[model samples]
Target: MVAARITVNGKETPISPAAPHTTVLDFLRERGLTGTKEGCAEGECGACSILVARPGVNKPTDWVAVNACLVPVAALDGQEVVTSEGLATAGEPGKPSTLHPVQEEMAVRGGSQCGYCTPGFVCSMAAEYYRPDRCAHADADGHTDAEHGPNGFDLHALSGNLCRCTGYRPIRDAAFAVGTPTEEDPLARRREQAPPAPAATEYTQDDSAFVRKSTLEETLRLLRERPDAVVVAGS
Candidate 1:
């Protein structure tokens, strides 16, 4: 079984005796973090969207949205993950927590209906909100133009998330309503202080092994060592 420690929502979680193929959705739900739902398990629905930050690389900011149902828990070793539950800022004693700007816009704009898909949408939108290219456009009123294509907000970001009960109008409104993030935003601070990307690591569970090589030389060496191993690419 794969055993490793990973950071979740800024806290370290020790995964002991976990199956190598255990999905991230299953692992999170088993820990009572049900905010990330399992919709199509095949990774097409985007209902299990979550933000993942690795040790290295910084193209689309530090974190990127991913489908939890299609990701193996072992793949998150030494990485950081943020679910819908982590979107809100912590509240003071006896005070209510403050929702992220994306969550607040979604609620105020009636973007959520049945709430089953809200979490996934929130996570995906949060990633887009933190994108570096998000500040390219904004009206003087500080709102994105929904009528225009490729404005400050990209509606295509939500293409993966599906909502059966609600229309896309309100959701699009919420997307446009998210103004340019201020320096006070938690994610903005994270982006400002993100660490460099991490090198690839290998993990093993029973007879199964998962390896992520940092360099082509290392990958070739491993392949030469295990010539009989099955090689599969892309989740």
Candidate 2:
């Protein structure tokens, strides 16, 4: 079997060949990161959603919402990826030992009922907030969508995350109430940001290689060829 190196969360992990058809979800779970769920192994559901970072900076990296289940395992090599386990530490710099503003907001506003989909939504929101090129433009809010932009505090972040228990009202309020917490958590001031819009999905300066595969055989063939591939699999 071929081998490869991958940077998950903030650590480097070495992976093995999967006979060509392993999903990123399986890889992550096997590696002990159960945060990347696998409700629907297909691209239709965002359960297996995780963050994959291609090197980029002030010029944000191109962040594409990809299906981990659909993406072959050999496509990820030398890539910087973030899973739910790493979001608290790797999210938008400046905050340490704290949950990402998005996730924290969801908790505060009662946005998390089942909490199964919270991680996916948080990562997705972080991508939206950090993508430099994906500007929301000056809507009713004076400036473009700031991390604390006016429209930035909306329930749409929950769209990627599913909620079967609590209705969307609390989730919406949570997304809208971020970074503006009450006396309960005073430090929230520095953490809050605005809601992200559509164009805000793709980050600038981000580089990622997208490899499409239909079956495990093709994926294994690719892995055998590119031992250093970065594969994101399903659980």
Candidate 3:
């Protein structure tokens, strides 16, 4: 068995003796964060899209959408993850204090139905909203991260969420409709666009080149040889 640590929402937890093949959806659902839903289970469908923020080697931080159902639980070690459950600000459960601007705008714009897909869309939008510099690029993609990137908006950011009820037009509208942060709520503004940390840490190892080890001894030897290396010894 292997041990791993990760921050869920904003808290850190350890996954020791974790099964080698556990998917992220299984881990979150098992841990009681059911806000993250699953529809197609494959990466093609954005139903399981969740924003994963991991310490980066080159960039400020790497946050992207991932198909939780297909993603292995072991991949989440030492990262900051935010789910639909993390949408609300720091307050009463489900309170709207720091309600992600996307969620707030979505609520006013009638972007949700049945509510199952709301969380996924919330998570995706939160990632887009949180990154200040992303708006310019997201804007170029036709979905710009700008508070007012597009009026009708594009399905590029939310392509991961599949909503059969709203037909996506209203949802897109709501996403683009989110206005600039106002002084009415300072917390809301903080959540929408957070400043980056002054210091950058080497929070993750490049798993793209890592090959699985067949035995514990081999894994130990590998780690000893390359102390800074990221090795996926086992599940």
Candidate 4:
């Protein structure tokens, strides 16, 4: 059988050699994508946030932020993930990469928390930045409030993340200051296309195994065949 693979930061990588029980956090960090941190393994801190392309309501695909600490790497067998590092655009050979709008605003407004939390905050903010409906409505006066910003940024997009050293005032300033994505922004353009369909995967290592059927009927058939199977949704 072909090996299960994952697309991370525009690169296709094999998911093998990793234990079936490895969390996406460990999987990513093992490959030196260390921006995803593990503050609370239980998914409370949002420090391990990463973006995944998923079916969308307003557009074909939505950049959804998910917790990496809880999900198994095998769960994302054929999905694409965008880490904090993936948000930057590569510049000329020696030049610094261009920062994503969220990262740019956070840096300019002093919203960066400690090294551990900054990437997570940036990723979650980026998801909101690309929301198709984020700027669709305009209040007559562009009034800013506690929960909503003049730029149409919703504070709830970041509610999952936690920070101790950096209070939210500066972070809110960053979120409120970002502008709509330009016509040339790649991630913004990505919203126009459909997200990748789930791949049929069967991965096993040691005594552990993971399986992803391509259709509902196939899944049901498998359930009948193995009543002891555990089911997980959304990978």
- The weakest ten consecutive residues by lDDT in model 1 span 54-63
User: Which residue runs does candidate 2 get wrong by more than 4 Å?
Assistant: 1-3, 55-60, 90-96, 133-160, 179-235
Ranking by lDDT: 4, 1, 3, 2
- Which segments of model 1 are wrong by more than 4 Å? 1-3, 54-60, 136-151
Candidate 4 residue pairs in clash (backbone atoms < 3 Å):
none
Best by TM-score: 4
Residue 76, model 1: lDDT of 73
- Cα-lDDT of candidate 1: 0.80
| Candidate 1 per-residue C-alpha lDDT over 1-235 given as tens digits, one digit per residue, 9 for 90 to 100 | 2347677898889765677788889999899999999998998888899998743254434667899998788777777789999989999999999989999999999999988899999999888887775655656675555553334778778889999886678888888778767878766667756543543757776878777787889889999999987664556
Candidate 1 to native Cα RMSD, angstroms? 3.4
Candidate 4, 78-125: lDDT as tens digits: 888999999999999989999988999999989975657889999999
- Candidate 3 lDDT by residue in tens digits, 105-170: 888888888877777877776655544344323444565443345543334667667786765766
lDDT of candidate 2 over 1-235, digit per residue (tens): 1235567766777645343445677878887888777776766557677776543444334343445766655456445567767756343566556776667777777766677766666666555544444333356647643333444543343356565565567656555454433344322221233312112011112243445455679879988997887665342
- Where is model 3 more than 4 Å wrong at Cα? 54-59, 92-98, 134-148, 151-154, 180-235
Displacement of the residue 36 alpha carbon in candidate 4, Å:
0.3
Clashes in model 1: which pairs? 55-197, 55-198, 56-197, 56-198
